[model samples]
Target: MTTPTRARAARRTACAAALLLAVTALPTSTAAATDAASHVEGQLPSGATYMMDVPAAWNGTVLLFSHGYTPAGAPNPAQNGPDAATKALLLDRGYALIGSSYATTGWAVTDAVPDQLATLSVFTDRFGEARRTIAWGRSYGGLVTTAIAERDADRIDGSLSLCGLVHGGVANWNNTLDPVFALKALLAPDADIPLTGLPDQAAATSAANALTAEVDSAQSTAAGRARIALAAALHNIPVWNQPTQERPAADDWDAQQANQYQAVKGLLQIAAFHRRQEAEVRAGGNMSWNTGVDYARLLGRSSVRKEVTELYRKAGLSLRADLATLNRAPRISADPGAVDWMSRTSSFTGKLTKPQLSVHTIGDALVPVQTESALKRAVTAAGSSSLLRQGYVDNAGHCTFSPAEQLAALHTLEDRLTTGKWRGTDADSLNSRAAAADPTTPARYVPYRPTPYLRPYDLAHHSDGQ
Candidate 1:
């Protein structure tokens, strides 16, 4: 990755401006769908839009798709599911596909869960009840789907969450806060980048730009690189997926650092910074806190700690001082009322009454792979561990999976539903199944373990503060 020099900074600024314009240019209201012989579209009284596609030969099962987060002002896709190929594959298999654009966007868990249920109700009312209903969601939709599974298990036969934030809302927000806090302490210690309570989009954008500049300046020095590595480690941001660039090998320190620099830069500028502001607005105050967080402890417990250490060693920088600095920095606290609101509106209980199969990319920077571990722990605590199965893709990026991988996952869940047992879930087995399903898009399943979440978060606390 090239250093974020003046030219590069200018390019980044231009790109951000272009993105802002594009987002703002989107139509405020959802567009009316063009109905086809096999497709149906409708809108609820609340203005939430929904679309459904049925194959000529209808299968008994319906695949309800919950889409990921849509940044405010961006146009929501008319149909459900992750990509066009997945929708095509499902339709070819004779399954029905349905999805909804919740009435409002931006941290819309409150609207999404019920809006989706309303969509299901409309679907059932239009056509006969599906023999089996499988709820599947990607990213934020994954959280929505999981919530449905827990609270409305009777409505669906099974569930699949792809790259989902199954980790409770509190944990998700707090975990993101880790790296942003580190960036502030190490790079822009005195910058007016508010970690919370962003007054508006302009304020959020300013903060994001400031942090991005800091990251750009720091990318040119060894100490700066080492500090970034620490920040990335805290969030387990993968040192892969540099834009339009091939991923570096695991042991390639220089290449990995470059990739990590890009990752951290993006995280601070858009993923963590901008998204948190939107979330704060929806929650009515700041919902994330780092008040009592211990940075050293967080780093020690991180999945990328070893990688961070190696990167620091290669950069000839002392990691200890940075850790100490983070420990001494003043922390941000959350508004209790806002925290409670987010907890109620979002978060999962893990009390699964139906089988759920979750698929995640091992190196997902947006929603860290540790989210799976946190979900596993919650289900175990709820005595619903038996109902949950997780699969990992040996790749990087957020929700980066081929149609083959997704079809194979759906099949895996279908198998459990059909035979009352898991079949072909091992990495090798799943890869084979995915290849057979679609030889065009090869599978990338791999056996890997994810680290446990460091924060104290669970359904019990989020549900009612019990």
Candidate 2:
């Protein structure tokens, strides 16, 4: 399994390759004419950059795209859509695409919600109102897209959230913190790693590197690997990381353990430590806690309990001592003010008023497939389950859908909106449509149900203390 860091680098390389292909495939004059006729770029008063593209034969429908999170100080590209292939296909099919380089990049959900709306306002003011509008986003952008669908249902017709953290903010952050808390208790009890409130990017990166090194060293032994599996299970990290391979078998201890270690390391460094730091800065303190949590109970309820048991049995070890140690360790507590702030700023109450179609990779480690489950529960509780449909691709890796898969999801949502009912959304049917559209990349759709979220922020759903 490729490490999370390496997988990200590979995605960047693939994007570069796609950009190169897009450039070389088009004649220079044709490219220039297309840009001249359809492309428009501008900036909002708040310094958010935006770009819009409309085809010569307008379809009267617009796709508003919200991009994934960008780290602070990273270059914010004016991406008009999710990927090169998707963008090309949308334009070819005569749908207008628009996107905003959201103001203040790192975890900018507060700014993104309004900034994206502002960009849409600008588009309507200049080009006239779109006859139909669909809000779409990937990863973090998916959360933003859902917020828009909930808050501006009258303005948008439908929404597509691809690999989004739709489980709401409190649950996402608390779940991320679970592994870090477990790692600290079981692996580095004496290490001076600040789990939250990092002063800056340098501090967060330094902490992440330190945690990664500890995880790397811990992977050398069977007991250490068992503890890592405990942490991974608490967060619902998938046992597969490679996109081209099937999930490792239960008894394939070596392969399964390696993937679990990677998941733990990646979650601690990126999601728990670094992202938590940024989130703490926004929330004014730590918003995650494990106070009064029962480690033994958490382990028993974990989806990967059987896998952990198998690993311990193969390694001639017992998990009882480790779980006891975790139970005895001092637990972290959240500041009340910070918890309130995060709850207000991050969580979604379902409350769906528009048609929403969410797509996720079955083996997404970072966001995890269980997020979709949480969202489903939320929508059900809100009595809007009729408005929601979720589809999954069989591949591993986060947001790793091919263009055909993505377009097929869009078409599925369009079908729902047009017919007022979901049509052909089963894995076989969706995969057949995707394959028919683009045979180059075979569809990997499967009927895989994810486990329930382990550390949901909702007290009713959480396994541990509220």
Candidate 3:
């Protein structure tokens, strides 16, 4: 971990350049064909349930799947693949798949890893030893996969993540905090909108409704829109919102703000209002704060800074004055215990003990592409860059990759695991491989480099802006 000064310095250095990886094609032996499949389901000692699928003629390779976040008390059903189509395809191709319900669901990282390992043990007890186990996870489960990659690499041959929050829980929450803090500061300064240290869901819901009301009202005026743009900039919310709509043209501030507004609204609907509150409970207190953040500098690093500035200028607003207000606004300080829990449970060392591949849509609103940037930095810092490869899709949603794309990534990891090194995994190669896997499915891999993840937090840089 670097000192606060050094961390901020590193953040600057990272934002100066982006990583634009080119694409390449792939070889398509995802798995060998198999016969009928058998189903297995059971529960762990921790109350988490698990499910598995083993083909009549198995390839001895097990794909250990980890599902994304499920709300607390929700129907925590077990998952053995990304979706039914992919699960069926993998089972048909002779790969055994397994996953668990996890003891509890909201931000279930701690429960997931242990539950997954237990499920694997159960599978081995029932179905016998797998020739090789490949760990795969999505969203928060992606964080679980990376943790497994680091702490339990010897148990798995390779890893794959989809739309994961790899920047760790601290940064993930901080990303949410930036928008809410800014929006509250500028829009509802006197409102009783609670941002952290929530006591229950009732408080969170009430606060969420209040914030949403403010943002909806704020969108109607030029002055209000300017302030919203500032908040969006600090949060690094992307200006391109609609997946089907063309990317907003440069200088189209109105179209851009409209798009950012969608993300802004989404930010309120997601982590800002719910997960942060939920996470505080999980961590035993608040896990996010903004005591020393530099709003102007943060905006400067945003991908949409130019658009924000344009909006502010057109609105005849003072960007400098607003930034000053943000800097001067009362800051939130995280509870030390909560911070410790988040750091220990969700942080990434970037040290990949096994070959890992991750694919994210370029326009992912929730788990932004910037997450990949932080991942690459961490990997590079740990000198594990060779053990990782990332690809981007030309799509614009969270965990939105089609089955073909998902399989293509799996095949790539399989190739690396089978061989002692990686083959073609570039955007072009991934797109081509995905098309080969399923022509009907769209494979929109494209060359992309993401800006540095703003406001990244870890134990080493725990003081963050301070």
Score candidate 2 by lDDT: 0.79
**Candidate ranking (lDDT, best to worst):** 3, 1, 2
> Please, what are the lDDT tens digits per residue for candidate 3 over residues 276-353?
777888899988788878888888898778988888999999999989988999999988889889988998778888
- Better candidate by TM-score, 1 or 3: 3
Query: How far out, in Å, is residue 316 in model 2?
Result: 2.8
**lDDT (Cα, tens digit) per residue for candidate 2, span 1-466:** 3455554565466457652111112221121112123577888988999998877666767889999988766899767798888788778888889989998877788888888888888777655567778999999999889889887787788999999988877788777877877787777899998777678878888888887787788789887787788788787777896565557886786788787776677676677777777788888888878887776777776667888887777667778877788888887788888887877766777778889999999888899988888888778877889999999998889899998898889888998988999998899989988887677776877887777776665322433223
Question: Can you list the residue pairs that collide in candidate 3?
Answer: 19-449, 23-426, 23-427, 23-428, 24-426, 24-428, 24-429, 25-429
With a 3 Å backbone cut-off (N, CA, C), the pairs that clash in candidate 2 are: none
lDDT, each prediction: 0.80, 0.79, 0.82
Cα deviation of 329, candidate 3, in Å: 0.4
Error of 3 at 436 (Å): 1.0
Q: Which sections of candidate 2 miss by over 4 Å?
A: 1-37, 244-247, 458-466
Off by over 4 Å in 1: 1-37, 242-244, 461-466
